[model samples]
Target: MSDRIMLFLLGFFTLTLTILSISASEDAVKPNSNDPVSFLCHEGEFFIKTRRNHSEANRGRPGEWKTACENEVLELDCGEDKTVRIIDVEYGRSDGTTCHRYPHFFMSCSSSEAYHKVHQRCDNKERCTIVANTDEFGDPCPGIIKYLKVKHRCEPVEPDTLKQVVICENDSKTLKCPKGTYLMIAEAFYGRADKSTCPHPKIKDTNCSAKNVMDIVGAKCDQKEQCELTASNSWFRNPCKGTHKYLMVDYQCIVDDLGYAAACENGNMEIVCKNSSVINVVRAEYGRGHPFVCNNSPTPIKPKGCSSPNEIAIVYGRCQGKSRCVIPATNEVFGDPCKGTAKYLELDYFCGEIWDPEDSPGAPIIKDVTKSTVTFTSEKLNKTTSSEYKTQMKGADEKDWSDVLDGKAFDLGKELSIGGLDPNDQLDIRVVKKKEDLSSCIPFARFRTKS
Candidate 1:
């Protein structure tokens, strides 16, 4: 062979060998798609296991809780079909024996920020890795041994199933469910939940959040197939003054059989369901979506968008969990939203098993009353740990409830005292417990101040 031919053949053989070696190395580290360790962690499954080695990391049953000691890495896998939702986390040793290698520093200590740190890294992720150490989360106790105890669940993420959307301040967004399904809101935040959402050049505070945003948005959108929202401070009063904020809504498309009915002005609309299935009101609108519907009257419908602000609450209060409900389409029930314009009552509902009336939290009970202060207590419904209570008050003749404490939510059963009130005043007070993202308020109670 000629010298040039020999050199070319040698180079070709070396390149082929190198390519084969690289391909083999890549295949060696690729994960098995069908491996049981790659499966998801489901709801209500609690398993406490140590993370020390690869085999130990994958050893526990799929539903067990996973823990990582300091300097150790914890892996959260929700598979390809689901995402992680951190329920709670503990960054310090709650008990003396958790990571008790150092007995002297095993005193119980916990960081108040463990949940937020873990959630920021793991929530809504298909796969994530977290380091349980001071670098990840600053040492809450310098001497105490700490571990990361995380409680999480895998939520399915199918097409058009679960969604997370962020609407910037002063902007609007419409959330809609797919055909044959209704909207179920999971989480709603009117204030900033994170630093990166709704970026601003001047506003940097991300720790502020609206107290009543869940209740406000839930009353408007829950059970509806579609809803529009604007993230303006006008709607949700500024939770943090001078800081730019946004609105975030996490929702799901729930599958259910829906029924619709409409009634023109000065008419009656009766909603009825099939055998044994009660009326679960999905949505109610006391206005016109289009000018063509109920066009029998000579009066003109000025704007295409007109709706009563309290339509859903009114309809839900009257018809929720009933086998048959009869409601009138009149200004008397739902106040006239747009006066002098023709309107109609449109409702969408589902036929399903009735929701237990007792499921709702009962009315607040007056614990103590004084001239300038009134204290009250309430019981939580569904044992929801994160549920909060908002109290309101109004004069005996007043028709609206004035928000107190800037619409802030207090922990359930915590005593709240309202001060700076006139003596001998007859006031009507009410309390509402917000369960997750649902807004239905419990019944109100009446109280009188001491003279």
Candidate 2:
């Protein structure tokens, strides 16, 4: 009986020692400084840990050994238990065949209970997956929890080539060649290279020069009689004549009787003069002699035919038939008729009648005359003059006069009659006495007859 009791006590003691040894071994494997275990927390998963060195004495305790491993397990804790927790997850080393990392991270939770409750809520959902773990669930430990930030990252992107370009007016920006200097390649450009060149000079040519050009304007000429050329300088007016000659003179070439070799000078030309025997010379002055005669004289004088005073005479041949004549009828001439002439002649005739001379001795029976005591009136007379009529005869032997009836007494027989007049009528007879002296002869005479 004593042996059996001692054996049972010994067996109980061995079992209790084996259980304590197993608990201690599990506690030794809890996360500590010497053994670091890494785990991942997804986006929106709360990260939580017991405080560092939390309950340091409880680490190897009888029931605390299992709690350490339980808390150290990788889980999504969303901080529902009032425990301090990381609200964001930071990326650490990833798991599986394909894994990636994120550059930035953010916090998502603030307390322990809220952290653990969030993990419990995402327990069976496809929202998250455990990436890595240091232990199983329900372990107690303070360990590092790494996570992958599932949020997208926005970065600046670059392009392959440059953008659209445009050319502006008056833009003088030069293009830099790959091997050459900055030069004005063209007037304008659009996309890249110089597609259009300047309108003036081309691309690879030099610039234009700065010089001036000259032009000449010819003068207008008027007449065909050789124009005189004048100019400012010798370059234009040298030897001015003919086709290209410049120095011109006043002389002109003409074909006259003098034969055509610079015939006229001093700006005057006899342009229309013909080359004939009678040369037509253009006189320079006004009153120079001309070939044709021109009469420029006054009239002449003449005289009357029958009178003379201080009168001008009409010389016998000087008067034309229609020429005017003048006569002096008065002491003063009325009109000086350009001639001193009697324009007409005056004459008188007389007859006396005789009867028987014995019957009427002293007186004749009748006496008549065609004209007696005539008065001549003209422009030559101051007033007038008269003439007498008589009938008488002169004897040759004695210085006496005889009656014209006595010499021819033998004609009438019974009654003697000299003129045809009646004897019964009383007639007065007048005899014209004639003297033998020639000086005493009557200037004029008239005749009378008895009845």
Best-matching candidate per lDDT: 1
lDDT of every predicted structure (CA atoms): 0.61, 0.21
Tell me the TM-score of each prediction against the true structure: 0.30, 0.11
How accurate locally is residue 216 in candidate 2, as Cα lDDT from 0 to 100? 14
lDDT of 2 by residue, 1-451 (tens): 8756745654565455446435433322111111111111111221122111112322333320001111133332222111111232223323322221211211121121222222221221212222222211111112223333222111221222111113222232222222211111001111112324322222332221111000010111111223222322222321212111111111112211111111111111122212221111111111101111011112221221122211111111111111222222222322232242212111010111111121111112122222121111112111111012123322111133334443222111122234333222211222222322322322211122111
**Tens digits of lDDT, candidate 1, 144-258:** 5689888777878875666888999999999998766656555668877677877887585778888656545654565567888889887778988888899987767666354
Worst 10 contiguous positions by lDDT, candidate 1: 32-41
Error of 2 at 123 (Å): 99
Which window of 10 residues has the lowest lDDT sum in candidate 2?
Answer: 210-219
| TM-score result, candidate 2 | 0.11
Q: Supply every candidate's count of residue pairs whose N, Cα or C atoms clash at under 3 angstroms.
A: 2, 69
